[model samples]
Target: MAKQYSRPSHYEQLMKKLQNDFPGSEPITGLMLIYLKHIVHVVETSSDMIVKIVEDLHNMEQEETSCVAKSKILIISHDIHTRLYQQWSSRTLDIVEHGIEAFDTNETFENLIVDLLTQLLKLAVFLMKQPKLNLKNAMDALHEKVPDLLPQQSVVHYLLEENDSSMSTPSEFLTLYQRPFDTSLESDMVWPIPTRLFPYN
Candidate 1:
């Protein structure tokens, strides 16, 4: 009978490998991975819905398609956006609740808080970069994501700028992600309407 080799313990293997990695590499890498994974989850979930809605819209607009089908495909982006926001929010909270202070960063805890905000900014950029969603719709969705910084004037700001122009989305909104207490934003917030008969801003 051939002698079988015993497997090394995971902790032992990790300890052996840590010598090559930086002091905090494991935890930092783990946290970064978690953050990136959450981002991918949100994007994947949102994009999947966006792609389906766009496909439906395209099918409805086809020459042989019926009017009923066209109506069904319209503005489904809002629903997708709403659900995406909810997912991002919940995941963000979970991250915070799970020993958020344990991460080792060069900056103080306050700065780490800022880093969390930047993650939201990255997510917003990712959402807008999705080609299936129009600029107007992207702006609308972003407004929902960052209500405080964007406020009521956000859509107008988004509209006033050229579609190709790059604007940095705010990070402040991410601080509220996944919190235990319910936010009071709902009562005070109001999304602006075009208010014109022709729908021109």
Candidate 2:
């Protein structure tokens, strides 16, 4: 679906339809970005309109096709209380040069999305920071931004990796695989009250 929306004709078609349907002449203020399948859509509308826009998008997809990949809201990467880029606009991603599939720098999918975001925001900043929603201009804008940007903060920043070493023992990452502790009921209440830590017990 991301690839489908990347094409100029398809992109334009959707944007045009959205504009006509909603009929907003307002400059984009808020973003509801949903990332899936290597695509992050930072939908630029007011906060109120975001859910509507998302619903509309899904409806359009369902109308055309017959299935939906994911539901309306999953903030893959966002700080909802804060808007990261003031100068950024909608619909500016160069999937080719900044190829997502080729984004194999030992990062997780969640982190890769953030990396893509860095490139996108930097691109918006590069273009003297304005919304240029034309085709060649959008493409041109994307390419220009790519050369100047780097991954500002990658997933590596957060994770505590140990010396490129491999572990022999099984990870304790999962807390439980057994029945936490076995429970037995001899009677409704045991005669010699066994020790229990919490009052809830």
Candidate 3:
């Protein structure tokens, strides 16, 4: 007889809980759950794309590829970044329409938003550092297209220039990102719980 697995994986349990708790009966809860699910899907898909982009970059760097080819890769990366920002902006709007009070009461829901924001910040930083991708241009586009997407003290502001020497590690980045939220209740209310992204670190 085959051995039986008694324990469900964390992801499995989380999915089961989500299905049980948010059954799409109420309008607001259903909308929030749908937005959260979309956000998770975007993050997962974008992460996989980023990994592939990084691997391609490595190979191109090894081959000393032509500027045109590198430019094409940069364009693709920028497009991915834009799509993520748009998705995040849509999610934010969904939350705002549903009201922060709705989410603030639920610790698990708040934690999920925090996790999503952290992943987005990390991805943004990673993409910003890629060669030939103009960070300023990307920010300008986001500002024009999704002006209310990010708060005033967003982690995007902490992104280092290619020549800057400070805060190379992700931990350092998180520290810089968390400083603005330490005393601002308004910021806290508007955004997710700003803390270290990696709990184990």
Candidate 2's residue-wise lDDT over 1-201, tens digit each? 122332334434555565566765533343222122223345445543444445445554455462333232223233445444453234433333324333335656456545656765664455434454643474354435454453322222222121222211012211222226767778536777877767883
- C-alpha-based local distance difference test score of model 3: 0.31
- Tell how far residue 79 is off in model 1, in angstroms: 20
- For the record, the alpha-carbon RMSD of candidate 1 to the native fold, in angstroms, is 24.5
For model 1 the local lDDT of residue 190 reads 56
Q: Stretches of candidate 2 above 4 Å error?
A: 6-26, 29-40, 64-105, 129-141, 148-201
Per-residue error (Å), model 3, residue 125: 3.5
As a whole number from 0 to 100, the lDDT of residue 177 in candidate 3 is 37
lDDT at residue 178 of model 3 (Cα atoms): 47
Candidate 1: where is the Cα deviation over 4 Å?
1-103, 133-201
RMSD of 3: 22.9
Supply candidate 3's per-residue lDDT for 152.
24
Candidate 3 deviant stretches above 4 angstroms: 1-98, 102-105, 109-117, 129-133, 143-201
- C-alpha positional error of residue 147 in candidate 1 after TM-score superposition, expressed in Å: 26
lDDT of 2 at 85: 45
